[model samples]
Target: MIRPKLELADIFRAHGPAWRQANAGHVSLGQLKVMSAIEACRTETLGGHVAGCASCGHHHIAYNSCKNRHCPKCQGPAARDWMAARAEDLLPVEYFHVVVTLPAEIAQVAFWNKKAVYDLLFRASAETVMTIAADPRRMGAQVGMTSVLHTWGSALTHHPHIHMIVPGGGLSPDGTRWVPCRPGFFLHVRVLSRLFRRLFIEGLLALHRAGALSFFGDLAGLAEAGAFAAWLAPLRKSEWVVYAKPPFGGPEAVLAYLSRYTHRVAISNSRLVSADDATVAFRWKDYRIKRGDRQRIMRLATGEFIRRFLLHVLPDGFHRIRHYGLLASAGRKANIGKIRALLGQSPAIAPPEAGAEPVPLTLREPCPCCGGPMRVIEIFRRGQKPQSRAPPRDQAA
Candidate 1:
């Protein structure tokens, strides 16, 4: 694939220094590190390697990727590898897409207490599904789900939400059989919404009572228990958005959907239209519109653009992707084996032992010059130049 003329790296290199200076102490260490990593990615600063095609005289120099989870240019390969690793886990059943969003009031608090609140969001959303699905009136089964957290909207705004992919069916409560949903339905959004709101509110209040939340500026009044509870009372009256789309075809389709949601950063390089000293422009979807064209271009002052991008810098060591229910890491393989059996399929393969060596994933991208294999011939450290003088290749990014 040809590279986009504009990139987050280009924007960072051009304006990051000035923006960093202007914001000084306001930036968190996590955001600063992300900026530094993106600025140095794919350049000589991080070093690289030389790959040569033995069948032909072609050679190329490929720079090392920072492999930062938040890097726009880096997520492609990351997503591919993760998909590969998860390929074996897919079941031959339809999958439903569910989204649960935090209301604006709670989102504001989440911004300040990211780790605490985001953790609660994951637990609450997961429990809401497990609880609702286990009811005899509902599916009455132990379903599995994969949840991905997205903290930014299309315009790089702070809109925190969870995207979940669930199998259209689940194992019976007694683990005796498979239970499938109606062909065109999953769960009632209204029921899910009410339960999610209640669980999340209860969890948030627990955190607050445990002195886990922080408040500042206009929200300082929330430091008091009475004020905080009263503030949340209004949210109880309002409806939170919970949407569940019809089930996708099957596991492969679910994999395709996950490729987009799982490893995504706030914005990708392709979305960048242009960046200059004064302004940066990019494409964003206007979701508020229900008809006609929803695509729109948004331009922000360079400083503001950088600020908005940094707004999504997740806390260090925080996980953005998680599995729950039958997908829980502990007994995933065994659970899948049982579910597959109930579906009249062969038993799933077992994973390797604790200290077993992993099989390498081999994806051969033929040489651009000739349809021949390309193999790494040389490795170099950061700030060092490769011995062979081959032109840089897009294979690296």
Candidate 2:
């Protein structure tokens, strides 16, 4: 993909210092680190290397990536790498895409209690699916799924939701048979929504009662038990949104979907139209529309754009992607083998032997001057420019 003319780095490099100073005490360490990482990515603030193509004597300087998960510029390669690793996990079965969303009232609370609340969101949603699938009336089998947490909508709003990819079937209770769901249907969305709402609310109440939740600003009154209960009163009756898309065409579609989502950031550079000293303009999709064009451009004050972007910097050490049931790290491989055998399929090839040196992944990025690899020749440290002179254009081999 071609790089965008504008980038998050451009905005950060221009406005981040001022924004940080203006919000000094209010900003978080994690957010500040994200800003710093993005601003310095592929710049002299980080070290770089010199790449040369011997075939044509083509040479150029290349900077390093921050590899920060929140960096929009970095997620492309991260997503590719993640998808490559997950490719082997796909099964020869239809996969369903399920979305579980937290309502607005609860989202406000999640703003202050990110780690605690999002943790509950992950567990409650996963448990709801696993529990429902395991019931004799539903599928009566153990299902496996991968759940990814997305905290931003197209307009960069803080909308926390889980996008789960689940196989349309599972291992039987006795672990002897593979049970598939009814064609074109996984589970009842209304039933999933109700159960998910109940489980999440129960978890939230436990957090509140155990004093694990904190209140601030307009929510300060919720510090008291009665006030907290009152705040949560209407949520119990309201309908939560949970929906499942029809099963994917096959494993190829599953891989394609995972590549787009697994390592996604709050926004991508392609969505950015332009930015100036005072304001920023970007494209967004208006999901409220059901049948018409949803493409729209939104302009926001420069400061507000940065604020919205920073709203999604997850808590340090908090995992945004998770696996559950058969996909859970523990026993995942073993479970897959069992399911394969039950399906009359052979077990997957063995992974590399213990302590064997793994093969390195070589990038096929070719230099523009000639169709050849750009081999790294010299390394430079941070805050330093390249000392070696570039090969003259006339010096082509």
Candidate 3:
């Protein structure tokens, strides 16, 4: 019997008329490729290639995987490998998680200028951290931080935010000593929030001046410079929602966090409860409540679920994971070396893991009458195949 997970895959495998209707005018090349890849994943559509069984002499025609980054089936291994590479970059110090969110008013703008707005979110958040940490009145040191962009809320709604995992301390400007933040506090959330709003608005204005942002449909009126400026005016006056939780209890806690938050898409397969007929059910966390007790399960029509998931596909080739301050990619190694020397901490080295390839999967057995594991046994490949089998299975028996 197919498990629910496999059932979900089966659903993804079919390019249902419903999916076509929902995405009729909205499909992009990337989405089309993703759907096609999922449909052809284990089927013969793309033309199956052979993978001979070492033991059974079975010439199994293994179908090829699409290997697209956005495919849910393919992202797990990709995320694992990426996390492994980043494991070596962990600092042996306390770290904090900070979230910078755009108000709904700005989210409308962000929806249209995702790449540009997201980039600004990263830059603005990083700058806020670095500036405050380096202030003599504050931490008085230079900090290293990593940021990841998340574009969706728990219910797969369009909510743009930046999540940053930052070391809780930094090196002094003179590079003479390590400076630690107040035990329970990093930067002032209110101050950071204000600055973030300013920086983001400034970047938005720049993009508008550069003719890079678009306003369409409901946002058509925002195309006017005065309208946009007026729209941004209120956000600057109100709190911009910079949230900071306490530092991760330790370095290990930080790693556990990155594993959960970074590289995550709008939803994970495990969250899916079921997909039957034309409805899909899934679980999500309602973060508005206290942290540990906020999970909820919800259901949506299959078309709506797919639409929500695809809303976060991201602009092509956009980098969602970003490094800032000392962790910035340009000179991260050298900076890490400098910081390690100052803090008297050695460079991080990932512990060795028992490297092993996973066992390949195969069907339990061939249909009893067919004997042994199923195989193409013979190939009339594609158009060359005989019009029909000599006899159907029931008739053959």
Candidate 4:
């Protein structure tokens, strides 16, 4: 039976042609291909081969997955794997959540230069935090943080913001001790906003000077350096928003938050309710409200849904996930080692866990109740339906 919370895969399986018609001119050819690939995931479109248990004379057919990061059907495993790698980075200190948002004036340029601007957003924000925290007059410590880029608002609109989960403390630059922030406070938002604005404008100017930004239609005038500089002039005087919320529930909550934000796209498939009659309904969270007041339901035309989702289509091969400061890629291993030494803890490593690796089909059949290994007793080939079997005890007996 079809359900309201069905995913894109289920939606397309139910109404592929109608969705295609609605999105024909709105979505990019590549996006359409992604949609098609998602539609065909775990189906016969990609073809499959049968596997059999020779001893038990049992078999089943397995289908192929699209594996596109944007495809809803594939993000689950991807998120899980990402979380597994990051789980060890958690520090034993209080963590804070800060969000730095872009002003409407820059949103236009950001839309065209997502990779560049977003990269700058991360850099500028990280630098702002480190600069403020390390000042002798301020927190005066090297602070470590993990930042996630969120490019959408609650309504699926393009409102770029970076959500950072930062530890309450950091290693002293000399790597001798961990310095913690004052209780209930991290860094000065006013100072952070100023630095963030300056850094971001500089990065944008660099991109513009290098001819890396694309302008079209109404924005064509911005192609000139004078016009671009003039546009940025007011932004310098205007304040950028750098908001810091209260400390999270220690390190655990911080990791939980990171696990959600780092992998988020414009929307998740689970939020989807239905796709029919050229409209799609879904759920969203309104972060501006009190607790228990955040969830809301919304609907949009199929074309608009596709448009919003595609708005977040990153430049190909751009690394959405990144590390900076202590987590910077170049010397992360050594840096982490040095940090652990200062904290009086060993360099972090993954601990063994059951089922950490993929479980094979053969390992799945040792029955817990019967203490016996079971094997597939029959083959279910492609295009061949499984025959009806004996009913459960309640119905058969």
Per-candidate Cα RMSD to the true structure, in Å, reads 2.3, 2.9, 6.6, 5.2
lDDT of each: 0.90, 0.88, 0.73, 0.73
Which pairs clash in model 1?
none
For each candidate in turn, the TM-score is 0.96, 0.94, 0.80, 0.81
The per-residue C-alpha lDDT of model 4 at residue 74 equals 65
Better candidate by TM-score, 2 or 4: 2
> Model 2 — TM-score against the truth?
0.94
Superposed on all Cα atoms, model 4 deviates from the true structure by an RMSD in Å of 5.2
lDDT of each residue in 289-337, candidate 4, tens digit only? 8788788888987767766876777667777666767777776667667
| Runs off by more than 4 Å, candidate 1 | 348-363, 395-397
**How would you order the candidates by TM-score, starting with the best?**
1, 2, 4, 3
In terms of lDDT, model 1 sits at 0.90
Model 1: per-residue Cα lDDT over 45-66, one tens digit each? 9998887876886888878889
Q: Could you tell me how far off, in angstroms, the CA of residue 29 lies in candidate 3 after the best superposition?
A: 2.4
Model 2 sits at a Cα RMSD from the real structure of: 2.9
Instruction: State the displacement of the C-alpha of residue 321, model 3, in Å, after optimal TM-score superposition.
Output: 0.4
Summing lDDT over every window of 10 consecutive residues in candidate 4, give the lowest-scoring window. 388-397
Query: 1-397 in candidate 2: lDDT tens per residue?
Result: 3457899999999988898888999989999999999998977678877777758867766678899999987888889878877877778888999999999989999999999999999999999999999989999999989999999999999999999999999988988889999999998889899899999999999999899999999999999999998988998999899999989999999999988898888888889999998999999999999988999999999999999999999999999999999999998888888888888877767766666743332134667677776677778898777876764222322
Q: Which ten-residue region of model 2 has the weakest summed lDDT?
A: 357-366
List residue ranges in candidate 2 displaced over 4 A.
Answer: 350-363, 390-397
How big is the positional error of residue 184 in model 4, measured in Å on the Cα after superposition?
Answer: 2.9
TM-score winner: 1
* Error in Å for residue 224 of model 1: 0.3
